[model samples]
Target: MSNKPTCRWWPLAMLGAILAVVVLTWFFDGLKPELRLDMRSLPPGAGHWLGTDTLGRDVWLSILAGSQRSILVSIGAALIGGSIGVGFGSVAAFFGNDRLRFTLRAYLAALLLLVVFVYSIAVLWPTVSSTGHVSVGISILLALIAFVAIFWLLLRRFNLLRSRITFPLDTITQRFIEVISVIPRLYLIVAFAMIIPINMFTLIVLFAVTSWDVMARMVRAEMLKVREMTYIESARIIGLSESKVFFRHALPNAIGPVATQVCFTISGLLIAEATLSFIGVGVSPETVSWGSIIHGYLENLQAWWLAVFPGICIYLTVISLHALGNDLDRMCHSKH
Candidate 1:
């Protein structure tokens, strides 16, 4: 009833509507020829909302399907990489023996070296067929293995925190906080690795890797600050182990900023993916991302609608994500 205009609802409302349109288009992508792209496809009138593409495919359908893939891949990358980063980061913060820190750093560096080596191979040979599938699978496996190894190290460190029975619950809670920290850079790195693979899965990983760095750094910074809090000091004084105090007392509180990052990450990754695709480094030409769509009609400057509509779609989606992140941040801080 307060007349303060609930900005919170706006993003949800817009997202819902966009999602609905995407669903409709996906469901009818092949059914109705409402926006089919053939020359016989008539101009926008009562029937077609966005007109047609060069192949007479419904512009709306193409946009919907393409957006779906982009969103799914981004979210997937965020979740996967984010979780891995958080686990290892939290462990390092909690029971961080100099040995453990050195070990993890060494492990991460080794992974980076391997990825670089593989990337060199990809750049040099660059197959354009099902080989992309193998490349993408290898990249994903490498990313996952690296993440898991780091997380395992973190888990082992957390076990040190658990020795203090007075705060056993706290040590377990570290996992969530740690995961959020790794999301930004880890996702970004995954996305970058995916870029050269020329496969759908690789494209998703590329976006993931490029986007997760910010989240991981944000989480780590928050944990660092939280580790110095009064309760944390008290927990240590009361004989609560370092791991317990670090995971239980500090982690939950640090999750506040993670939501905001998620919103920005989504929008940013979309633009990044499109840009990559435009440069011919993202998904293959057969893929229907907004970037590919734009590339398809780059020479046909007169028929600008092909590129215009997809660009608009990207803009709208990004704006909606940004607005949502802002609203979520407000909601989170308001609670604090």
Candidate 2:
């Protein structure tokens, strides 16, 4: 029994560790460790605390340098995911029990299609204009195909609404959340990572896209509770606009759960990024991440420092984020 509180509180110390890592990484961001062929696979010593990797880059320095991108990607993904989840979840909460002409799945599909459209243009325009690649035509054609598919779905949705068909938005959202939850995130990662070049941008977009549904579910639940509160009603009765009411009052009350969800998302993303790097699917080969340092261990087991140090970084970071998330979740539940 005495150990319970100690176990619970110990993770708080990790908060300091995370802060230190962030600061260290930021300080060293512009200083990437160069390859030292003569010093390859050296063990930890005065010159190199974590030793050198197969490429002879200082392992400790590599971890610190790579950490900046990984940590930033996780935080960026969580922020973007949280924003999207809050928007969608709030909209669902507003129309909740009332039958709605629109469905979340349709909404999601349309939104995704629009993103694909815009992203494809941004990516292809340069190639088509300058390089004139045959692949650009194929990409443009594919984008058009995706647009047509979404248009068909929207057409059917229009027909249903025209027929006076309506659905309980809450039920639709819950079922949509379940479906999104079941679509194995790793599968999406593999599918996209294989097709698209994996970099900081792609990783952030991938992590953000896959992480939002759970957050949306949490936000929706919180919003439901907040909507029934006396203060929320008072705001509405005082002629405050719905958007202002939600942004000013409802979002604040509902933000706790979303905050907890973001921490969990970050924890999961850190592990995922490491796993991707381990499998050689992360950022470019030159990009030295903690996982990339650990990847060297597979080559030479004798270089144990290659794996151990970076592994410690990943493990400690994930643990810190997970523990923090658990604490936040507990606090939110207890207050509710």
Candidate 3:
């Protein structure tokens, strides 16, 4: 018999365990108040497997409740940020004039660099809870500028189309894209306006602003390259309107890179969250993340299990995402 341990089953096994933890936590959270952890009556005995935390609350329950926070933050941040980044980048790719595109590239590069610097500084002196309002404000502002830059680029593209030729409903469709683009961008601005002082939500906002551009830039580059392909050129030569060539031929091909970027981006964001939490700049102490969990165990290094569990979670998340991106890249190439 092969010595190999059916490694393929590992991911499924881990996922199953994670799912079980979630379900069990949900069940326990809904338990009768009296049935919950009663520190006075409990010890490291048969009933309590993991033992109680400092506050006499069940460590297991705390972990479960905290997972809800962590997952929600990650999902919310990814959706908000990913949408802005993808939508903005697509507009820039499809419609921008050379000048607008160049300007946008320069600005985004600068902003990304600035964010990197900020992240480094934040990492050096981590806090239990960062300035959520400030982080949210900065993120929203960055998103707005990025979105506007992208919209301007798309507008220029539409103008180019208008100068060359038009399609059926080109005017209406162009106008609609232009208008809808502005709406999402505006939401970013409004998000800044309605800022609350919640660290978890603010961190999500931060992640959304900083992360999406990488995906957007990748998508934009793919679109630019695809637009110059033989099919696109032929379409243009045959007097096909710009929108038709962009939407029908170019955009679809560009989606592969975008999808791959998003997969990677999600993984990156999770790591970023952990990093932020580790340094004390991410979620509040009230919440639990791999980073915060590790932070709690930092001094208590002897308690290896405390750090081990969270570290594993972080590593697995990153690895899974990297694997997902690689698979998507292969699939995309195979299709092409």
CA deviation > 4 Å runs, candidate 3:
1-28, 31-45, 96-196, 237-240, 299-301
After the best TM-score superposition of candidate 2, give how far the Cα of residue 84 lies from its true spot, in angstroms: 1.2
Q: What is the C-alpha lDDT of each candidate?
A: 0.62, 0.77, 0.57
lDDT of 1: 0.62
Could you give candidate 3's per-residue lDDT for residues 70-140 as a string of tens digits?
Answer: 55566677778768766766656666543122344344444666665565335421332344355755665
Q: For residue 334, what is the lDDT in candidate 1?
A: 72
* Candidate 2: stretches off by over 4 Å: 1-13, 16-31, 97-172, 333-336
TM-score of 3: 0.59
**Lowest summed-lDDT stretch of 10 residues in model 3?**
161-170
Q: What is candidate 1's CA lDDT for residue 242? A: 60
lDDT of 2 by residue, 58-93 (tens): 987798787877788888988998888888787789
Q: Which candidate ranks first by TM-score, i.e. highest?
A: 2
RMSD vs true structure, all candidates: 8.3, 6.2, 11.3
Backbone clashes for every candidate come to: 33, 0, 4
lDDT of 2: 0.77
Error of 1 at 182 (Å): 16
Candidate 3: residue pairs that collide? 95-157, 96-153, 126-279, 127-280
Order the candidate numbers by lDDT, best to worst. 2, 1, 3
